[model samples]
Target: MPRGFYTEGSLARLSREFDVFGPLSSDPEPWMTAELDQHAAAVCESITRDAGAVTLQNLSSYLQGFVDGCRERGWRSDSAGYDWETLRLLAVCRLAKEHGFVR
Candidate 1:
């Protein structure tokens, strides 16, 4: 179980409830880790396909929210611990760059 699993789950839930990326009719937790992996791949593809279309603002907001949410959940932001939140943000950033969301 990767640490980002929790963050991915939470983001998926948020996306579903708010229709951020449209409706997600699947179990987010069980699929979170996999989803993150897929998201990273998608981003890379999008970058190679069309760099101009990639949107970093939205991705940054999402990552910021994820970090804040994890902090609210009692995860320390200044440590190298293998906590769920920390891992999630790290993965999110990686994906964001792969997708051309971040530079």
Candidate 2:
């Protein structure tokens, strides 16, 4: 599969499993919400140690997971409430392109 497609599929799978909705709704599916929260915490921890540790591979997986989680929960990217996942995904995409991971 193409890189973009692969990335998107990975993201979708993670999203479905995690049930991450956008920032709009406070209540997401219990299981996924908790898992996503944990993932976010891990990401934050990783960032504090070394920003460079956030490589293309790691960012790609993280962004995909966030996007998929949000999408599965029926959250809109444009919603005014919460879009941290969406924005994070965009940042990762840019980094991936800069690193030649995509295209």
The window of 10 residues in a row where model 1 has the poorest summed lDDT is 16-25
Model 1 residue 12 CA deviation (Å) reads 23
**Model 1 per-residue lDDT at 56:** 58
- Give the top-scoring candidate (TM-score): 1
What are the lDDT scores of the predictions, listed in order?
Answer: 0.47, 0.48
How well is each residue in 78-100 modelled by candidate 2, as lDDT tens digits?
44432455435433443444455
lDDT of 2 at 39: 53
True-structure lDDT of candidate 2: 0.48
How well does candidate 1 match the true structure in TM-score terms? 0.44
After superposition, which runs of candidate 2 have C-alpha atoms over 4 Å from their true positions? 1-7, 10-52, 76-85
Evaluated at residue 97, the lDDT of candidate 1 is: 42
**Residue 68 displacement in candidate 1 (angstroms):** 1.7
Clashing pairs in 1: 43-99
Question: Count of backbone clashes for each model?
Answer: 1, 4
lDDT of 1 by residue, 53-92 (tens): 4455555555666567767878654453434544355455
